[model samples]
Target chain A: MSLETGTGAASDPAAAPEEAAEADSLGDLSEFDVSSLAYGAVGTTVFLALWQAAALAVGRTYLLPSPIEVATAFVVELTAPTTFTVPFVGASLPATRLTANLLQSLLHYLPGLVVGSVLGIALGVGMGWSGRLDDALTPVTRFLRPIPPLAWIVFAIVWIGIGHGGAAFIVGIGAFWINFYNAYAGVEGVSTHLREVAASLGVDDDLTMIRKVVLPAATPSIATGIRTSIGQCWMIVVAAELFGAPGVGFQIINAAQNLATDVSVAYMAVISLVFLVSDGAFRRVERRVLAWRD
Target chain B: MAGLSEPSASEPRSDDAKVVVDGVGKVYESERQRVRALSGVDFTVDDGEFVCLVGPSGCGKTTLFRTIAGLEAATDGEIRLDGDPVTGPGTDRGMVFQEYGLFPWRTVRENVAFGLEEQGVPEPERSSRVGEMLGLVGLAEFADAYPKELSGGMKQRVGIARALAVDPEILLADEPFGSVDAQTRDMLHEELLRIWSETEKTVLFVTHDVEEAVKLSDRVVVMAADPGRVSEIVDVDLDRPRERTEPAFADYVDRIRTLIGE
Candidate 1:
């Protein structure tokens, strides 16, 4: 009986040469469609118009400041607080101001954003990579995750005093969990077959395999976490400032105490603007880092 | 599938006949029941031979491949590669699963170079070898493409190329073309044969298609479930570029079918 040994290119020289040619017919990589951009533009425009209309309807600036008043207040507060003057319908309205207060607010916001994000990412990656660690730490994480960031204010003030530390602590509490959950979920979501592929290829050790394979595979999820954490950071910034410190939240509270509703609404507008800018920056970074995902 | 004259009495044993599985059996325990995946599965694949294990679904073909690859432990009997027992997955044996297990995140070049990278091959050499393997699979242009972007057939080809790039002693494939369409499967079979002939790596391929087994194997080992065991070992005495409709091909197929009570 003859055997089909398979090692016979030299012995039999005339198989289908066309198959190799046909392999070349595959198409080039295509780009994402522009339809998504159209959808996004339409959604954003509708949201902005609705927000402006709602503010106008509320009328009592303190309860809900109109968009135009907030814009005018923001312009006046931002320009040369040394000689700040508000412009309203071709008339100037002099107002009380504090530029140093903006800097104080930023001090709290920046530290909380950086510290909370770093710790959260590290904790999440650690928990994700080790099942033992996950078992040991999950209860603590779940217990803490459900508690609101503001709930930590009492402890923050008791431990670190009632200024920047307390506010930063609250902000960190808010940002930390968003990043932690995302990173953990990302690592857990890594494909089993991909891990097997790595193992079968001689990357049998967990550490090396994680560094080489799991880390990159889980990056998209981690990136999502970072983006979400940025939004959370902004949300907590005002809340943290509201607790004490002299940021935008404190300014809003002060305006309310003085019964100046328009000024309070103006600060809220600034917060929204800051959030939009931060979101834009994050979107740019996401595009560059995840370019390979396409 | 035309038959050839039998080897002469003085004919020397081909160099490819090196893999020896002597009375191998595997029994897996699942909670409360014992499933026999293979029993007395004996076969010898020459050093560079291409053997296909063909059987119906739930048969022990896949179990045998896994056992040989050292991915699954055998319950009874031994499998010797060259002359050593396979303890675990090593560089000596490369495997290709039916699902192209390419990392979706990595580029085509990276997936092909994964094993080499694990071996700690230098960067320059790794890059060159990756390029060469990609070329071999006719995917050189897609070196930077992600796995998600490739067609099913293309992904499987990369899987095969990745397995081969490591220069393993044997390739254990578990229904490697099972996920693709009929046309793609036929194309892959041809491409596989071409690669096998060129590289001369010992291959133990698993498949449920009778015609595929006849076309690709020097020896088609038929298997059955329900206390899984080797039903028949049919020597495919057909020449290269096999024609499926030939009488000898039908005879070999009939023999296997009869042995399996099909």
Candidate 2:
């Protein structure tokens, strides 16, 4: 026992001396650790400095507005109501508030995201677990998964009649495939040995086994799928609304045609801001759910 | 089919055998060829007996273990527990895996309670049984700890506790100590013995290690590869706390090694 403790206490004698020597040379002050927040601050500062230099070099607000101009445009866009002309009806629509546009985008985005993710995960898990189902679904998914989300816009316009529903259809398609592949890979990647372990412990039935073992084991992958879709769906929302909808994307396009480039940049910034908030919120929840990983 | 903790009246009284392996064989068939993993394997583990299946790399010990556990069906013959045909994994048979297949998401206590929960044991009683199992494995202090935080030996102990939670008539262990360090393996062997005596459950341990078989087993079944079949059965009447350095222990090891064509 004494010998064991002796070895443990002097486990790294060679390293210990070097550490002492280094400590003497360095004095009592500890090494400065660059935290994530500090790194973010430095990165933001560098980015703004470069942007300001570029704006000064261009000296053209219409081409590339200065940071100050864009900031001022952001404030104007945040408070101002937006209007769209109905070309076919020959009538001007009522001016919609910025908050209303944001809500309009979410109206479709959330439903599209929830429904698509739920269906994708369900299909992925079902096909992965059952050999018969996998065979039947493989070819269908293979053919469909390759088609891009934007490619569905024509169908969305025809089927959904060009509204928030149409935009949601496009967004849903994008989220679906991402979540499908992730969930599929997750379920497929589960260790066969772990299944046997579950069986040995009396988790014999298929449904119970899936619930008790397979789902929990595949959670990390499923969580990754959900988080990825959160960001991917946001990208689709901005692009999906380019047709005709009350969202930040439509606002950007409307501003750009009028030579209000700063307003366009402001809308783009709002998209980025919205994405950051959602992604950050998701990460916090993801960390809690996958606490077992830590 | 019954509560594993209580032995029924019809439980194999005359046979005194907890497990009976009768001419069991498992064959895997693919497109090109048919591979016979266990060909005409026969063995029996009596109630409260400590038996070890020792063999070389390609041996069907693991295959046979799985067959008994009912995780894999024998292509020929059958395995019986308490004189009833073994269909699939039930509360009556529990297993310990080599890789320590404890659910990383669950605490040690929850893991121990897993089988019991499956058995539909409820509330306060389940908690008490979990407590007892943790105490039995000497992991009571670490009940709330996750599998990731425990050492290899501790994880194996939790595995054992989980298996024993449902009070299975037989415990099948596939190289349970294979991953632990040498000193920890020795400590686990002793802990297993103590638990075995205390619980009085029949143990069917499979390993490639000859010394481990000699040190722990009441009877060691030696197996060979190439169609994978049992070649010999050696009875180890060695006393408790058997030393690896002893000549008798060395002889037993030599015998098993020779039997497996080592």
Candidate 3:
């Protein structure tokens, strides 16, 4: 999801209070399963029917790939032997729609994510724990924070070429700041009383205190950073592909450039699927990690 | 000044007495002002003695404890643990904070073992000692549980267990039961007394609660807060399992409160 869509999706339950004062806050929206299901079913049907009717009126399959045509394209992609050439790894092996493309994206995304998160957490926590260091670093971070991740595309390309290196660099840049801010906030937000308690316990050394007390207390915020980075990494994957990498982003860009609208939409769907499935999986992991929070 | 003995570290003492604070005073100086937190505070405790420093807020009861624990420097007095000056905090001085400052990420067992581990105790002995302390604090079931999962009282139990695991010569508790509710505080008081009886560690507990001091302490030292001076020292002499509603309890609490006011 784009940032706005992610935010909007987040705000649906949050904004119901504004939409209707009398709405049931506690009552489940899915309480009446039949009605809710029917509402969704009817909405989908009406939307597709209207879209089909509009396509027919336009009388051009190229301009408005019919829903049926798009479905056929999706099936074709599902059955097709999706293969690509890698400079280092010979001809890519045959794999399923779920495995080949998805795993390829993960191969690139995971390394960048791990590296970026580790660095960000270390830097953020370091600055947060020390007054002198934080003061020295604030101006530099502030100066760099406003420059968008895409703005770093030129540097990323120069530093790491146009393959996994470049894409990972771009993805890392996208994810780094979110975690940096979150980890910084986490350390700064630790309760003073808690620090005093640690001091009284004879664990007054800075590193020991942070590792033992501050980090645990600030976990909820750190989890937020991780979640935010997950979303950003997915976004940058697409952007990275646009810059000539072998992820879904590159697939989408390649299809769009060729004016293969059906293929473009199919790749878009793939991107959405990757984001949704990965987000859900990460959410499960995050809940388990922060089980101590609540 | 009648019952208050003058500064005399050279005075004869039995082998049973373990800690002596003679002519101790604390002066905090800043760019704008100077505050003398304590003055000529002389006290001594026998091993296994339960002494409570009772006072109003900011009375420096906490400062006195910190000084005794070697966590703070006393400007003009000497604190001797078994006739040795307190240079710094050591394994012998175990401290329990009111906030139940057990490491949130650590299991109860790990937190209890922190002090022993710091002292470089071997793993087998550390684990056994930690187990023993957890049992002493009635937290054996919570050995694997994290502090966040435990209630306020249970967290304090972990804190108590952590201090006890070190096998300290003395336990310095700064309002250790202040954060818990009345019922839990009462329960913990009983638990603490039992632990104190069993382990025989000298305890210097500081609290603003008059009745708590009277309930747990063998002697209650009340202090007044403005510049923080010792007001009076009352010998509780009440038996174990103190009766809060008893006339003597009420009388002691009222007397201490009034002394603090004056």
Residue A67 alpha-carbon offset, candidate 2, angstroms: 1.0
Query: Is candidate 1 or 2 superior in TM-score?
Result: 2
> How big is the RMSD of model 3?
8.5
Candidate 1 lDDT over B44-103, as tens digits, reads 777677778888878878778878877778889888888787777777888899888888
Q: On residues A79-121, what C-alpha lDDT tens digit does candidate 1 reach at each position?
A: 6444322213344444345454555666677778778877887
What's the DockQ for every one of the candidates? 0.40, 0.59, 0.22
Model 1: residues >4 Å from true position, as ranges? A1-60, A82-106, B1-17
Ranking according to lDDT, highest score first: 2, 3, 1
Question: Considering DockQ, where higher is better, how would the candidates rank from best to worst?
Answer: 2, 1, 3
Q: In terms of lDDT, which candidate is strongest?
A: 2
Worst 10-residue stretch by lDDT in candidate 2 chain A?
Answer: A25-34
Per-residue lDDT tens digits of candidate 2, residues A11-97? 656657665555544432322333555788999999988998899899988888888899998887667776655435656666545
My TM-score estimates for the predictions, one after another, are 0.82, 0.88, 0.82
The per-residue C-alpha lDDT of model 3 at residue B235 equals 78
- How many angstroms is residue A129 displaced in model 2 relative to the true structure, after the best TM-score fit? 1.4
Model 1: docking quality category: acceptable
Judging by lDDT, tell me the better candidate of 2 and 3. Answer: 2
Ignoring the other chain, what TM-score does chain B have in each prediction? 0.91, 0.93, 0.92
